[model samples]
Target: MTTHSATLREEIEEMIAVGELKPGQHLDETELAARFGVSRTPVRETLIQLASMGLVVIRPRRGAIVAELGPQQLVEMFEVMSELEATCGRLAARRMTREEQQSLLAAHQACLDARDAQEPDVYYYKNELFHEAIYAGSHNQFLIEQTRNLYRRLRPYRRLQLRVRDRLHNSYHEHDGVVQAIVSGDGELAAHLLREHVMIQGQRFSDLMASLPQLRQGAA
Candidate 1:
């Protein structure tokens, strides 16, 4: 995809995520192209990327439509993500080299700095690095790839979690627990803490749905 396609993708994703693109609504390539003052080629390419992310679906004759997951489906993805993260933490606790441990602590410190400065966006980026450190530290190539893929799939929803009132601070404290457990080589506690860290609670789920009104709307 070109630079234009990448920007268009973000725009369309924002529309779908915020309810401007209703669930099941067809994404007319021609209209999008006209709207963006570009050729349909870029819009088409943008939809392809969105389709890959489960944010849209490209049909044989139906064009593209928004992808909406039921609440149950959302919960299921989070559960799987939590388990994967837990496994990564468990392995990293016992398997990480001294250098890896230092890197993980550095990531955690970055998160603390972001939290103290109240920069959710910074915290969000730092949080990704922190998780990636643990994922890499797991030393399981297959597991790293799998977790990274799912992590990207869940990116939008997880990023919004940072905007939840006081969520960044809360997440920092949670990270503290996981870091301590990992630093001490307590695989069991590290696993447990990491699982809880990523699992979206019922209240958090509702909060996310409320924030993204499109998520609660009926199919178009």
Candidate 2:
């Protein structure tokens, strides 16, 4: 794909993430191409890329639509995500070098600034850098690739969670523990902290569920 295709894909992904493109909403290639000032070929390629990332569904006759997951599907994906993150944390604790640890600390400090500024979008992008640092610190290429793919797939939901009351502060605090455990080389503790951090349970789950209706309404 060219730069145009990549840019198109990101724009569409952003739309889906922020609810401009809702679950199950049809995505007409022609319309998208016109909207983005691109050719239909690039739109088609972009849709295919998004489909691989589990963001778009291309049907035999029905064409493409934004992928829709039920509550159960969401839970299952997050369950896998939690495990992947835990493994990354565990390996990072054991494998990261001094330089990598310092990088991770830098990422964490960036997140702190974003949290204090009450800028969820800024924090969201910064949070990606923080997690990516840990993923790279794991030092296993295959695991890093798999973890990154799933993390990108789950980006929108994670971003949405930041908008929940006090979630930004709480998330930063959670990162603090994760950083400490990894920097201390406590693999078990790091794994445990990361698992809990990634899991959506109790009130967090309720908050995410409550936010779905508003997302749908935005599309409507």
Candidate 3:
């Protein structure tokens, strides 16, 4: 909550975003403290917060390490996200205000512009905002919180998927479909489409894993 704490949190998050702190990599408290010109106390506090967010894990003797990205975890997150998004869409269709709909549309346009610029990372961030706008529009606090948590959990893998061949364009098209369904106030259609949209990532991960011999062998 303090300015120093906020800065430490932001720095840690940026490290994760840029892949400097990769999955399953240990976080060196002494090194981080040296880098930030701070004491171990603040660094430890920041690590604890990150761990609470499921971004890092603090073990008894091992300190904090980046959380491992497992296929099962990805599947579980997507399954939960799909259900949350579907419920959000369904509720938004029936309860959204005019301003909320416009806000969602605006976020979608921002995503389109980012896509046009061929900035996949920017597009992905905006795309998250677009879906999050919809979630907020649903006016379900519990759903919003849960969806945000899952989104954070799957952030790294989602970033990886954006780099897949033509996935950016495909994602754009899917967002269009979701917007159309929501705009038409077709709750059932919107819910179903959103569910499918979220699940597609899981399928892609499966296909990706299948194509990687090393991953397949590791699984066995």
Candidate 4:
């Protein structure tokens, strides 16, 4: 994306993330152009990009509407995401170079700082970096690219999930377990820890329903 389109993309995404744009609401290129003080071309391009993020759906001759995932779909999506993360962790445990391991530790520490500073938004961004590092450390280029794509698609829920009560603290401890397993080259333990961390099963699923009603309600 061009710089202009990238900026507009983020603005539109933020609008969706904050509930300013309800699910299935149409995004008119001309209207967005006017709102953002840009031409329709950039707005069009941004909408297309959002579609790729699974945040918007470009319809036939109908422009774009916010994409909505139903409850079953949400659960299914998380299932796949969990498997992908587990695979990354397992691979990273064995493949990560000493330097890469240190980088992952540093990313984990950044999460610690974000939580201590009472910065949920800061933690959110750092959390993405932390996961991306695991995908990278997997040293499997194909898995890295595939995992990164799905990671972007699921960004909003993951960000909101971090805001649930003591979730930051819980996630920190989860990271500690995964980090220890990876540092010790325990692929099995790392994989299990990461699967549990990302899957949002059992109590974690309940936590999402409680904290992010919009996301959960859409599925219902």
Candidate 5:
């Protein structure tokens, strides 16, 4: 994708994630094009791609609306993410290179620094890089591709969870455990810890959703 399209896609995704564009809300192509200061052609193409990604729904006459998130989908996504991260950890324990291990440690340290500075966005992105380092270290291209797809699908929800108080600190600790297990070449321990770490996010999301009246009302 061209830079314009990629930026448009990211903007739209961010808007939806932040609730600027709510689920089931229609998206106006002309408005998006004007807001983005780009032509409608790229916007239209981006919408189609977003629709394919299940971020939006495109109807013949009604244009696009944000996709709804239900409990079932959330559970399914967590299950998939748990499996993917576990597999990545398992492979990484056996296959990780010295440079990859160093990179993972560096990324984790960066995340810790970002957390100390109270920069959630920077910490979140660095956390992503930390996980991506493990994924790349797995040495399994097929697993990497599948995990990337699942990670993208869950990005919005994951980003939202970053705002939960002290989540950054807790996540850093979890990443430390994962790195320790991997560095020690304990594949089973690495896999178990990774799955637990990822699944805990799901539990947190569930608890957060339960406590949010607006979210409950929306689901109702």
Candidate 6:
């Protein structure tokens, strides 16, 4: 994506993540252009990019609408995604070069900076880098591609997760554990920690679900 389109896409994704643009809501390109003070071209390009990420659906005659996934579907996807991440962590623990390990540590430190700053949005982007570092550390091109595809599709939800009260701090702590396990070359422990880190369940699941209703209400 072009820089303009990328920026527009992130902005739109943020709106969707916070429920400012609820699922199934139409995304009119012209209106979006006006809203962002840009031309229709970039807005159109962003919609196409968003469509590729499964964040929006484009219709034949109609325009684009935010894509919707049922709760069960979301859960199933997360379950599979967690396993993919766990596999990456397992392989990375055994495979990461010294340089790659340092890179991962740098990414983790960047996340810590953002978290300490108490800037969730900044932390969110840094969090992406931290995860991407692990994905690359796996050194498996096909595995990286597969994991990234799903990660992009679920990006907004992952961002939304941070909004679930103290989740940002909790996530940072989890990342710390994951980094330690991988750096220590503990494949089994890394895999287990990564799986637990990514899995959305128990109180986390309840907190996320509870936040959604409030977001929807605010949007309404």
- TM-scores across all candidates? 0.86, 0.90, 0.80, 0.90, 0.87, 0.93
* Model 1 per-residue lDDT at 17: 54
Model 5 lDDT per residue over 8-43, tens place: 887787677666788899889999999889999899
Quick one: best TM-score, which candidate? 6
Give lDDT tens digits, candidate 4, residues 1-220: 8888999987787677646677889888888899889999989888999899899999998779998766577778888999999999999999999999999999999999998997887998898989988999999999988898888887777887887889999988899999999999999999999999999777887877676556444433
TM-score of candidate 1 on Cα atoms, chains taken together? 0.86
**Ranking under lDDT, best-scoring first?**
2, 6, 1, 4, 5, 3
> Which prediction has more favorable TM-score, 3 or 5?
5
- Residue 103 CA error for candidate 5 (Å)? 1.6
Give the per-residue Cα lDDT of candidate 5 at 140. Answer: 98
Residue-wise C-alpha lDDT for candidate 6, range 27-123, written one tens digit per residue:
9998999988999999999999999988899999999999887677778888988999999999999999999999999999999999889888789
- Where does candidate 4 stray beyond 4 Å? 213-220
How accurate locally, in lDDT, is each candidate? 0.87, 0.90, 0.80, 0.87, 0.83, 0.89
- Highest lDDT against the true fold, candidate: 2
Tens-place lDDT digits, model 2, residues 48-88: 99999999999998899999966687788888999999999
Model 1: how far residue 203 lies from native, Å? 1.9
Clashes of each: 0, 0, 0, 2, 0, 0
Report the backbone clash tally of model 2: 0
* TM-score for candidate 6, residues paired by index: 0.93
lDDT of 2 at 173: 96
Looking at model 5, which ten-residue stretch has the lowest summed lDDT?
Answer: 211-220
The lDDT of model 1 is 0.87
Error of 5 at 175 (Å): 0.6
Task: Check candidate 4 and list the clashing pairs.
Answer: 70-219, 71-219
lDDT of 3 by residue, 27-133 (tens): 99999999899998889888887887788899998789988766687677778888989999999888888898899999999988998898977987898899888
